[model samples]
Target: MEQNILDKANEWLTPTFDQDTQDRIKNMLAHAPKELEESFYKNLEFGTGGMRGIMGVGTNRINKYTLGKNTQGLSDYLKKSFPNETLKVVIAYDCRHNSDTLAKVVADVFSANGIHVYLFSEMRPTPELSFALKHLNCHAGIVLTASHNPPEYNGYKVYWQDGGQLVPPQDGEIIERIESLKYEDIQFQANENLIEYIDAAIDAAFAKSTIENCSFNTPTLAKENLKIVYTSLHGTSIKAIPGVLAQAGYTDVNIVKEQETPNGDFPTVKSPNPEEPEALTMALALADNIEADIVIGTDPDSDRLGVAVRDTHGKMILLNGNQTMVIMTAFLLEQWKRAGKIDGKQFIGSTIVSTPMMLELASAYDVECKVGLTGFKWIAKFIKDFPELKFIGGGEESFGFMVGDAVRDKDAVGACLLVCEIAAQAKASGSTLYQELINLYVDHGFYKEHLISLTKKGMDGLKEIDQMMINLRENPVSEIDGQRVVCIEDYKNSTAKNMFTGEITPISIPKSNVLIYYLEDGSKICARPSGTEPKIKFYFSVNAPLNRAEDFETVSQELDVKIKNIIAAMQLN
Candidate 1:
């Protein structure tokens, strides 16, 4: 172990820390030196969104001290930002182990600093915290969740008054303030008078907004006809989704009781993440047994959703984030056009790594499609920046979608409603969701996307991931599967270079550690590291013209093979 790591661990053994934390440090010092080093090697800083990590007794972990420090800094910053007002903030947590305790600790720190807190009485979806922040007219909000990460992991995400995660200057300023504070500086004493427990009323209001915003021209009979199988995957979505669906008149819904309970361990699945198909096995099986039209599963925090629909062969198939987003955005656009709302002043949002089909759809409707960096914070920022434009909806390729900007984040609750509306309307029109997707491809083009993540854990793993990016940057790939690399966009340096012409242009977006390559054949490959995890992700997207719906499977297979060939050629496997 390094001397600095040991020194940091020793500082946690002081009188400032609790006895249990001190005992754990002592045990690590006596018996688990490697674990100690891994736990204390570095402090868990806020990433593009917020702080997330494994839970334990170290600076690098999610615990009382680290979260306390964040809350203290945020409290000070909030006070400074709103000096003349009575500062108020709301806090919510998911069904993760230790989340409720950590949430109380955060509320205590904020209340100790003379800030009023509206803490949730029990576990709630993360998006509700965003909604409640603005609904309650609070200045900031915090939610204790690690999204789809394992039970051992937890996180703290800070939302501003706009209900979006901290972005740009605020993110950097809060990070600086957090770094300036020591563990001893965190105020843990609770001001009972300043802390209030909140529930029920907020849930009703959020469900109302979700229903109103996501519902379109779908008939009442259509909603009744759509049979759905839904699962919370042992997370917090159960607290809102079931009620929302019933209230929206979708009474033919089946809940996977095996996974409905809010267990932090996520006992029903290997991982609580909906993006993984295995996590939705129970719901899929239920859908099959019930002969349902659709299956929807939300992650622990209820921010990302995984969806499945019966294909042409009547086999249940999972749709990737891009597929879902394309379908949802197209549906929203068509509805808007029918309502005479798309007057060339409306726009939808997407990330750079998302499928290019979104742009095609936007062009078809004569609306703008703004692409931002990874993270929905940028999409939320779009609503703030371009107030003149009507913000329809937006999403990234991480199984996340935001509907109508009601909540300035990826909201699976509202997205779930939107998905059901699409499915319900399709069924009522004598079309299936899968057929609608194929029809969209016939109208636009067939686009397929694949994502692969390489996890590298521990301190050495971090260095290896960084070195991989470094190597890629130094020696860019000039070709992939015999296709010429026409352009390369380096977001880190904010530049896009044309390989053949040697022309360079500035990319007018916030700088991030991401790289993208565009091929002459219209293939795009993006390499980005996860902002919240120890994994690096590579996104591959390929598209082809679909003249008719009958050729959908053949063209889709071709694109899949093209993506696989690109992946193999790049040696990413």
Candidate 2:
């Protein structure tokens, strides 16, 4: 065992820690040397978003001690940032195990530090937390949710006064404060007078704002006829989505009973992420049995949404995140145009890794589209930067969509309502949502996207991921699947190099460890390592013109073959 790790473990056995944590550490020290080393070798990093890891009794894990330290650091920063002001913050948690307990710890630390806290009375969706922060005019906010990770994982996410995750200087500053904290510096006691519990009033306001943001007016006869099915996947959406959907006038809706209740174990699914097919299994099954018009499922925090709609053959087909974004963007733009709300001052946002079809859609409506880094915090920053323009909606290819600017983060509740409204409009116009998707492809060019994620676990895995990025940059690929590589965009260095011209231009975005290769055939390949998880992700996008809707199947198959060829050429599969 490393001496440093043993020394760190020894400190936990002192009276500063609880008897239960001390006992667990003593047992691991006696018999589980490897586990002890893994737990104490290094501190769990508080990244730009915040900290996430396996829950356990160590500095390298998500536990009371780490959480308390983080809260104390945040409290100190808040005081420094807003000196002499009554510092206020809001807190929420999901269904993950220890989420409520961790939330209490966070609140206790803040209150103990003479900061005011507005904590949710029970579990709530993360987006609602964002809404509460902005509504109450708080200085900062915290939400405890691992967000679709395995059951053993838990996390903490920080938001600023803007109700978005920390960005640039703020993220770095908070991280610096957190790193300076010691276990002994964390205050674990609570001043009950400084803590207030928030409940129904906030929920009502959030639901009202969501309903008002819908482009379509109240439930029309068409919308009333739209049949829908939804599942929360044993997460926080169950507390909010159904109520919002009903308020939006969808009369016919079915809930997947098995996955409706909030459970940290996510009893009915292998993973709680709506992006994966397995997480939506029960919802899709319910949709098929009831022949519902569409199926919607949300992750643990209800910030992301996954959708399934019937294809041309009347078989249920899950739409990828890119496809969902395309459909939503198109529908939103069309609605805005119909309402004469688009006067060139409105815009939409997407990530660099998401499909370029969003840009085309925005252009069609004469609206500008802003591309940001992978996280929604960047999207929220765009909103802050361009206060003169209206932010209609934005999304990424990871099944996260935000319909309006009411909630700074990606919101599945509002997105769900908007999706149902689009479906109703489609059915009223003598078409299905799937057909509308094909129509969008025909209008804009057909764009297909695929994602490949490789997980590398533990300390060695971190080294390997770094080395993969280094190797790619050191010896870049010049060709892929018989196509010439025309451009290389290295986000880490904030440069876009034109291969043909050998000219490099600055990319106006925050530095992130990501690389993109543009092919001569108008295809784009992006490689990025997950900031919150132990994995690296590669995103591929290919496009072709669709002259007619009848050729949808043939064109889709051809695009699939092209993507497969590209993947094989890159040896990703």
Candidate 3:
């Protein structure tokens, strides 16, 4: 058994992994040897996002050793990319297990290499990290977080000089540098002189910037009579969310006690995601009891917002991500237009998988709407790609999103602040948020969307996922729920074709492993593999005009049923 495992370790210990890593592998083999093979069978590859895995002592796991290797590669690329330049980088961590330790490890490596480091003294929101990168003029940034993933998981996210996730040539270059390093060669020593803990200055800057953009018209909006409920879903948002609201003059904010504190396990919610209504159950119930005006939630890192508003029947109904994005975008555009804030060159970005209602609204309002591959990084890329255009806001169908470009990433903090401002705007007009949504739908046509994810895990399951993508690419489904395919947009192939008219066009977006089918009846189906998880997702979107407000309930219920029926018909369930 020892011999067999030794052969396995030798198979993977290429020159890039170094002597210390190989010695550790050998030492483990000498004791609990078979396990060592499992640990070092492969070096964790740098994914589209940064490194993420279960924490353990393995080349494939997320530990100090693995993180050091990743940081070393990133540092090398930073030096090459900014040679002869004064390079500064910001580092931050969430409340996940070992998040702070991993963040410090990253700081150590960069500081040891003589790069300036502005490290967060404690765990903070992901967006604040992005904000620091830009506010301090850092060339790069790193945040230790797995976002809403489960307790055992942790991750590394790299950012560019623009405060957005790295993109294209830079991302590829960093990956190359990381791939070139051996574990032993990573600069792991601390250079305390070059690394400074940043808390007060950045906190002040972030809060000041947020307050300066405060949109609420009156301090009276925060009166005790107007009860507001909030939850962090056991993530980092709780720390600053209340302070932010309080600073905004919202004194009546009630916290969901169970989820107020940051915990990596995300003890209260089964899944720490704000997109799912189930995750908001505790906060929703609390809001109902207090007759709250609104309920808001943020994911683990506090970059995305989940909102619940009083419906027509006065029930606290939660809005799905699509519905939430539509409301927020319409409100921002409307507010900007009414205030004459639109300079005619501003733009908003969203993923291709997000609801197209925003696209329609943007066109109607004469604002440019840009669609990128699914991820905030692409949104940031769009911001960087066009320096002249002001990126007002961006979001995805996932609960993760951003309301401003200040941080260059999805900011749950900014989202929370904006939602309060939006709520204030609604209250000032004598309409609840639900009513405001209906107003948008009444002016713009009604659109409803839903998503389904099929999880396929483990080694065999991983293979099956790959095969599923191949199968779909090979055998395209021409119809779903009896609607004939009108157009097929194969993002992988970078082509869009008319199934009937045979009209061909190029998709200007970057190539991704996504397939979208548009039906003759205007229904749409999209197939995409989860970038961060082992799941295949199918998104269905359907639209119908709402002739009257009374029909809102009936239409919404029907749309929900239609979405499920279509999913069943497609056998994605």
Each prediction's TM-score against the native? 0.99, 0.98, 0.93
Clashing pairs in 3: 29-33, 303-412
440-535 in candidate 1: lDDT tens per residue? 999998988999999999999999999989988999989999999999999999999999999999999999999999999999999988889999
Reference-based TM-score, model 1: 0.99
TM-score of 2: 0.98
Question: Compared with the true structure, what per-residue lDDT tens digits does model 2 show for residues 213-252?
Answer: 8648634798788889999999999999989987777888
Question: Which whole-number lDDT from 0 to 100 does residue 515 have in model 2?
Answer: 99
Deviation in Å, model 2, residue 219 alpha carbon: 4.8
Which pairs of residues collide in model 2? none
Instruction: In angstroms, give how far residue 310 of model 2 lies from its true place.
Output: 0.5
Q: Between candidates 1 and 3, name the one with more favorable lDDT.
A: 1
Model 1 residue 310 lDDT score = 96
* C-alpha lDDT values of all predictions: 0.93, 0.91, 0.81
Ten-residue stretch with the least lDDT total in model 3: 216-225
Off by over 4 Å in 2: none
